[model samples]
Target chain A: MKCWLLILLILFSQSTLSADFAVIVSATSGIDVLSSERIRDIFLKKRRFAQGKRLVPVNLLGSKPPRLAFERRILEMDRLNLQQYWTASHFKGVTPPATQASLASVKLFIEKVDGAIGYLPIEMVDDRVKVIYEF
Target chain B: MSFRLRVIVLMTVLSLAPYIVTMIVMGNVYRDDYERRIRDNMTHELDITNERIEQSFQSLRKDMAFIASLDTMDDLLTGDLDKRITNLLVLKKNDMQLIGWFDVIDTDGNVVASSNPDRIATSADSSGLFSVPIRSSFDDNQLGQLTIHYSFENLDRFLPESEHSHYHLIVEDQQVTGPLNTDPVISVSRVLTDWPAVTVTLEQERQFAFSLLNSAENLFVIVLLVGIFVIASIAFFVATIIVKPILQLSGTAESITQTQDYSQRVAINRNDEIGQLSHSFNLMINGMQDMISRLKAENENRIKLAKEKDRAEMLQDLSTKLSRYLSPQIYESIFSGEQDTTLGSSRKKLTVFFSDIVDFTSTTDQMESEDLTNLLNQYLKEMSDIALRYGATIDKYIGDAIMIFFGDPKTLGVSEDAKACIEMALEMQRRVRELKSEWGAAGYSKPFSIRIGIHTGYCTVGNFGTENRLDYTIIGSAVNLASRIEGQAEPGTVFVSEDTQLLVRDHFSMTPTSTFTPKGFSQPIQLFRVISSGVTRSEIVIEESGFSLKLDSQELTEAGRQDIKTRLLNLIDDL
Candidate 1:
């Protein structure tokens, strides 16, 4: 009920925030067309590919509900463990997924970058950014 | 025709004849060659197009066969769901640009898979594509056919590009596609391999052979025409060389024939055959001219002779007219070139005779003028005829008196001349009697009597008077004595001078019949009468009352007396 209430309150505050999110890639990414397991592997930094293309995972703003839902549903891990895993992966020449404060920045990054993978709200997704996976 | 023109025409004909034949032959040959070339080219083109089509079909067949042997094709046919045969076909179709599409057919003639999946279940359209059976390689099993639709764009690229020749495809004896040329053309065809079920045709324009022939004919005509002109010019040049001398010779010949001048000659200096001919022609002309000149001379002589003959005939007519006026002795002397017409007198001894009708003036006065003229002319004509017969040249006649002379222009001798004069006088008297009787019978009854006188003496005998008007005569006292003696003589009597009596004494018996004193002479001359010209014969004379008759009995016959009696009786009855 609290989660439903938070979702409603976030939706009711339409000018500022939203609950739904979208998984996207750069419009020209070879990695845009992929399935669910590959999406999970890309966000956990467990594998660097969907098919044979390089993968990119993007985050929403901190404490966004879509990010937590992505960690629980797609990664099947909590946010702190995912962060710890990414931090530990950095010493091995690995990096965690990047974060963007707004869907617009994420879309901007996706439109400008090649082989980039991210998630945004379904409502925010457009031709500039391609949706590869959804949670 | 002029020599140059003739020769030029001849040479032109001769030179152009062969060239014309050659031109025609070359035109025909060119046409034949072009036709042969076009036919061979068509045959070659047909072969090339058919080979191209065969190669195209073979390549398509190989591709289909390779595709049929593929593992994906086998796996897909055996129901392996993971295998993507249509995608493989898409890659192959893209690789070979001429392949339109491919269909994998099951044995039931159904398309199980295709590059166009929408076309898989629906009936496949294999209208113009090659449908090759895709048999399994391992078992020779009957796999479904693989229908391949070849791109027409690629087939079109195989067509030959030629202006003279074109290529086309014929399938099942029907024209499916053709070369760009649409008009009528010569064509050759060849069927391709049996699998393609098509024929390749090559076509060429109908006028191709003639086009080559046209160019050849133009070239032939140009060359032959030029050759004709050149040969004709040369022939004219040669003809000029030959004809100049011949023309000159002809000119000279024409002039000679026209003017009849034989002296003209044609000059030639060369030694060729024409020069020889000119020389020979000149020789013949010279010979002819010689003959012509000779004939001309002969004709001139004949004309001169003819003129002379005509002039002689005219002179004869003039002399005959003058003989009536002049004495016949004078006329003969003048015409015989013995006497000149100049007025000069000469003395010659001549016997002169004079005779007249007795009392002619009294008798003639009683007669009419016309009857008198007739009587005078008759008397003169009879007396002159006797005179001429006896060789007495008549001198003159004075009003019925006739005077004659001999021994002047021509004479046997003086004696012969006198005797001839006497004989002539006797004959005159006889003819006068006859004429008188004839005149009396014609109604003039005057009894005509004649008196004769003869003389001989030296007299001037020549042309007398002016040179323009002259008379050939004798003029002297003898002439006067003869006339006066005739006046004194009785009718029917003849008398002569003493000179004539002496000269004719041997030939006649003479009587001193009369004497006359002439005015111009101082002495009287005695006139002797001639009694007879020969030995005396019997004679009879009857004279009474102005009627007189004389008869020579030696000349009378019995029959003649009887005739005279009968004539006298007839005359009495008329009286």
Candidate 2:
């Protein structure tokens, strides 16, 4: 009975973890609806500008569900692959996205920074930030 | 104290006192200076350590601010998922040789990136010693803080620890670097300007701080002792040199006193004052020796002179006693070295004299022996006085008689000798007449009367005796003639032989008496009575068998003369 309960808790956590997340920017940024390839290029520092505006990207620390989903859906890379791509990009004078410890910090960074973008849980996003790409 | 001891003491005091004082004072000064220098050194080290800590903190702040301003630090928004900021922090830590962690903290106080990877995503345990705020490069907004979690061990390089000194980091009034030294010789603390709650302290141990001073003081003490020893030794040597000669001089003086020998002298071989003293002493000794010898000579001379004086006195006494036995002339001649005493005789013309007290034995028989002695002595003294006055040499004294002579030892011519002898007899007769009255007054109605006789002829006159016993008397007929004449003389009358009368007829008045023949004389000697002096003629004497008269015109007063004239006229009428 303990194992069944444990199994059910895992399933419920999985569903919650799989909920929708979005790439966000400040509401005043005037940037919106970025494509998944454009979002990947921006996060990887391959594209520094979007919609004639300089772009800044941010990431959550470690493998959170939103970051993983962002890497899988927007960058089309897994953790290992994205890490390799950033490593390669770093040598090329291109760095990976900035980091925040939590989705709240990511949302705050996006709201406070100009041309800034980061991935967070859709529930964490507010009127202060706008969604650029979804996963 | 003795001179050497005094000198040594004075020298030791004089030499060592200043040295010891200087050593002590200098030692104190050096100790103080060394102590001050040590303290200053500690302070300097503390200041340097504080400067280093401050510089390190400043460098750390500047580096943190620079790292915060880096675009790479913007990765904090992604929570450093790629570990970019962490990699940079690690590189900086290694490059700066930092011993502590560098961290990027979120505004929520969670560490997003750190030099220590394990600290990432964790809440910071403490506020860092140095911090800089992370600002968004795009918007210039402060996102989080860049900080260093400095281990006190990281400050160990700046805060040196050794046997002599130690360092500590004080945080909020707490020693964070091991245990704090409770008691230290020197302690200095400095607060960090960037981190007000942090302090750097340098501490020095008591033993280590004063070690140099202790060693310096010991060396000074050793030097002082050595100086004292050297001074004492020099003082002893100098004192011996000075005092030795003085001691020798004193010893010589003492010996001189004990032995009563002024010849002793001090022996010195120096050319200094002590040598001069010795030389003067020797000169004084020489003077004393000379004075003593002179005194001795003078004493010997005095003794010899005294002995000579005693002999002269004894000879004078012998001469005085012998003069009574001899005539003055003979005595003078003998003592004056003019004559020699010998048993010899000479035939020379001499006038001999004899005198006797008439009926001396018969008169004195009726008197006491004392009276007799007085009368006899008186008579002899008077006769001898008269004899001596006539320059007669008294020959001998017989019973109641005195034998005297003239012109033997000394003579005025034969005639003058006879005259002088007759004059002396007349004076004797006159003196006898005067003494008759004196004796009559002295209790004898029949006083003594003396009779004198004189003769002039050739006789043997000289010392006439054996070699042992000698007599200076005449031994010839002239002497017998003078004696027979004296026997025939009337009492209180002077009689002379024909020879004497003939020779003295011009100088004295004389009357011829009957001749007398003496025993041992071959011829009858004619005698004459010696009356008054012919030169004066002041007296006339008349004598006969039944009556005698004497008249002295000079002696008689007018009344006496008149009385005598009347008596004489009556007597002539009776005749």
Candidate 3:
């Protein structure tokens, strides 16, 4: 019901757009905290290390719910703008974050890959992934 | 004022007129232009500042949108769990130094996370520049609104002091907040297209901006005032240069006119027009001095000539008066030194004639003085001419009578003088006849008949008068006898004393008219009535009328003549 209301608000007005997302990392990543900027840089492939660890960033699939939240909140881009951003990054030899199929998949990816960061819903969070940033 | 001062003032005015006008016109134009340009500059700066402020807000909105779009926002969407969202907002606030604070509000309008941990779960205060929405990006879902608060200290840095004065204001729901700068040159209001409920305002003080604009005009005024002083001093110097010599010349002219002293001249010397004028003025003064001297000489000469003429007129007038008072013979004798005008007398044989008009006093009493004078002049002129022509010396005139004498001064002999005197007397009576007829035609009704008495006597004839005035006349019994004989003479006849008749008996015939014992005479004297002289001395003719009356007063006494005249008058009355 809350999602429907949010959908109704976005359909009617982009000026009233609202978003909330979280930045997550593996429990063994050795990064207890991250600023919103470091989170965005890692997800956009602009950064590779934080706290002296080689960082890897993961995203849900483009059709999945958290991918939009990750791109909009962390990367600060819309879907079309993100696509254009990736295309421009390709010429610079950079790529988008690695994709996962679901929230659990993102959680599992963050859990296994050391120095890996991803985004997830608050409810989908557990002790396996560390919450670095939230909006 | 003096001429030099006047000239200086005039020149200063003449030269400064255009400058003063320009100052007035330029000052007005500059003031007007400054006001317009200051307003325009204020408006222009306001526009630029308004654009910058809108850009700042857009940047702030973008910052808010970006922070809301974070993947961590899903944490808040699906239950924030702890202080994770608040920590993220703290970092975001640090990124935007202008932000007062940031709060992530839940969809239910609760402050889920904020830079201030105390603000968490508190209902978000929406009072700020703008409150942007946070959305679920993948589903286009409304999550919460991100309310941004701006720090005035940081935002004020966006406006510069070089803009003279500026203020930023917000108008929301008809309520205004921010700096209230009244008396602003420009007040600009802007409603951003992205945020309709929010309005931004900018303002600048007119006084502050106009102060900078006044600099050019103030500088011009200073320069103009200094120029005026320099020009006025120059005008004063020039006027002194030109007017000094002219003033000197006028001073000389003024003194000359006051005293009529043409000899004075201006003593100024210069190298300009005034020098030439001074030279000409001196020449004119010299010429006037020469003319004045010449005119004075001529005037003196005229006065000397007039004095000579006055002396000559005095001599002529004295001669005329002396001739009127004295007989021509006596006057000539004195003037010619033939007789001395001293108080003395001498016995000389002189023929004297006395003549008088009948009823002369009655004739004058009946006439006006002008007519009487005419008759006397005509009679005296005729008698004098005849007397002078016959060489008789006129003694004097007593009213209508004349007594004259011949001999002594010039004489052929005593006998000849007597004969000439008798002839003059008869001719005088004849002239009266002719004159009376002529005078009657000129309004004189009464005719005059004359009687003459002649006497030849040895008489004292010389000056007999006081020391101051002399009377050159004859005196003694011979002169008296002539007067008495004239009184006894009948009208229209000449009576002669025996001495005269004895001297003229051969030249004229006489009638034994009367004899009388005259006053102071011891014996009666014989007299004769002489009727003619020169050609026909006497021819007694008689014509008888029907009745005849005759009287011989010689046979009677004086009382007998009077008695007979009264008896005859009574007899005529009876008849």
Q: How many Å off is the CA of B348 in candidate 2?
A: 3.0
Which lDDT value does model 1 have at B395? 78
Candidate 3, residue B189: how far the Cα is off, in Å: 9.6
Please identify which of the two predictions, 1 or 3, would achieve the higher DockQ against the true structure: 3
TM-scores of chain B alone in all candidate structures, in the order given = 0.63, 0.56, 0.51
Residue pairs with backbone overlap in model 1: A21-A120, A21-A121, A22-A119, A22-A120, A22-A121
Q: Write the per-residue lDDT of candidate 2 for residues B189-211, one digit (tens) a residue.
A: 78877667878777787777777
What's the CA error at residue B362 for candidate 1, in Å? 2.9
Summarize candidate 2's per-residue lDDT along A1-135 as a digit string, tens digits: 999689557745764676488888899988888988888888877788999998888887787877776776677777788778878877886666667766776776677677888888888778888887666
Report the Cα lDDT for candidate 2: 0.81
Best by DockQ: 2
- Which parts of model 3 have CA positions greater than 4 angstroms off? A1-135, B1-48, B71-131, B143-155, B162-261, B264-272, B298-467, B472-481, B487-512, B515-575
**DockQ for all models:** 0.01, 0.13, 0.03
What's the lDDT for residue B568 in model 1?
73
lDDT of 3: 0.75
Clashes of each: 5, 12, 23
The C-alpha stretches of model 1 lying farther than 4 A from their native spots are A1-135, B25-207, B247-267, B278-324, B497-533, B536-545, B548-575
Model 1 lDDT tens row, B1-575: 88779988988887788878777777678667777888897788677776776786788788888887653454333321323567767777777764467787767666767776675765655563767666543234556777776654455677866676666776677676754676678878777664456667777778764675776677777887788778888998888887888888889989988997888888878899878988898899878888888988999999998899899888789889977887677678778988778888888888888888888889878988898888787777877778888888887777778878998788988888888888888777767777877877888888588889888888888877886787778888778888888887778877778887887777776767556677878887787776766646466444334566566766879999789779879977986
